[model samples]
Target: MTQLKTLFFAVTTAALAGCAATPRKYDDESSRALNLARAGGVYDQDLRDSPDGTRSYRKGLFTTLLDVASLATSFDAPLRHLSGTQTFMFNATDIMATPDNPSARPSLIGWMPGSLAANQDDAYEHYVTVVDEAITHAAESMSITATKLTDVKTPEIDEHPLMLWSVTSERYDCGKSNCIIAYNIQQPTYWKTPSYVTGREAASYNIAANHPEEYSRLIFRQSGDERTFPVGEFYSAVSADMPPWIVMYFPPNTVFQDGEPLTYPVLYEQGQQLMFKEPNHE
Candidate 1:
């Protein structure tokens, strides 16, 4: 059921974002794209049957973790040796959306997954632990990290508030010509952590949006870096070849420092919310 919802939102919003691909961008009252960018897995409520260490989750602190495992199972990644640090692993594959457009990227319907033991505490939760480790590994293995980020802030629109952080590190980059992608994954959702944002100002982070950029589509690193379809990497090479309607992840207004970029996690409070109640939201 949850996967179904994700699929609906994914394809629908992707279509909305894709509308801009035509001549003269189309700015409908649609917030579908923004909601789609909320970031999460296709398996969410459907992966309960996944093996010992695999699962799905909504785009949250822990959703990144689920992405690592789910994506690895369905897609291949350039980075290796990340599994050792992960808590679980998926043993399945062959579940991905391989669009037939050179400009599009592969997405997923369902995929295998992996998991790791989680720790429950006030100072930190299992999800935060997962994000921290991915960042650490991305830094060590990818040799990259965002340069400036004290708190979440919009990189594209300075006045948009610090809802997200951006990075310029190699690991975070898409390694493409003009495109780039960056994100960290958290562990699977096992009801072990809070369902929503839980920072000191948790009440401030429930903001949701649908439409994204005029020049770009705000792609969610949903499954984070775990899936075979890397976050900002290629759209699966499968026969379903097409450019991604949604682009990869990045902070709104990223900055470079000493030749590299920095990032901070996003905090979507009510004020940080986007316009999701648009007429085209459905």
Candidate 2:
């Protein structure tokens, strides 16, 4: 009888261990939406047809634990929001010395360019202050605009679809008779690598040679229609540090008018306007 009891206890312990190792289903709509977005869905239909069903697939016990442990560390720093009307001027010196003051040259080191570094540091400090102020102003404007554009009780998720826009660097310009403006619908942020250095080649390689269905590059000619642009010598990868962007060439003498509204179309949303202004100047 003693041996039989011991055997029963061992089997019970093993069964409990197996049960503990199984992951529970995440059935919440938010989790479902997040998973659908991560899987590279471009439209509501794609999300509705996800094979994972309406709930999160059961992960291994170890994998679920690891995800919970890394939650805080995986959070991304939020982007600095600048005002729609604010323009950042390009200053080589300011760019070189930003986020840190240049180290002072040794008093006896006559060969060092200490004064130039000091000047750069000063300019950088001033530029950062200006940028901070602009961000604050922009936030205020955004709040006011949101109030006017949206019903007070409407949730943001219901008002806006799960979509992201690709913001191009203001400095990009090609000398042409007429410049083209393009907007490419991007995969969900979860599908992208966190570091550009590690994933650049894979992201920027020719779409046809890789996951063509996951990416579709669109070009907008001055004629306001979609067209194909030559994918010149393909780059190995995108710069991880840079935001997703679309390149367009403008016609000669076409300057980005200050105070003019910069508009881009929302993917999947037919008649909604996502408008801002060029925040940088040549």
Q: Please, what are the lDDT tens digits per residue for candidate 2 over residues 1-282?
A: 999999997786555433322222333433322222222211112112123221122223223222211221222111113221111111111111211100000000001112322443342333223323332343233231101111122111212211111222222221121122222222221112112111122222111101212222222122112112211100101111111321111111111123121111111101111111111210
User: What TM value does model 1 have?
Assistant: 0.22
Error of 2 at 61 (Å): 49
Candidate that scores best on TM-score: 1
> What tens-digit string does per-residue lDDT give for candidate 1 at 92-187?
111112122211221211000113222322212332333334344443444444232333323332122111223343443432211222222111
**How well does candidate 2 match the true structure, expressed as C-alpha RMSD?**
23.5
- The superposed Cα distance between candidate 1 and the true structure at residue 220, in angstroms, equals 8.1
Note the Cα lDDT for every prediction shown.
Answer: 0.26, 0.20
Worst 10 residues of 1 by lDDT: 105-114
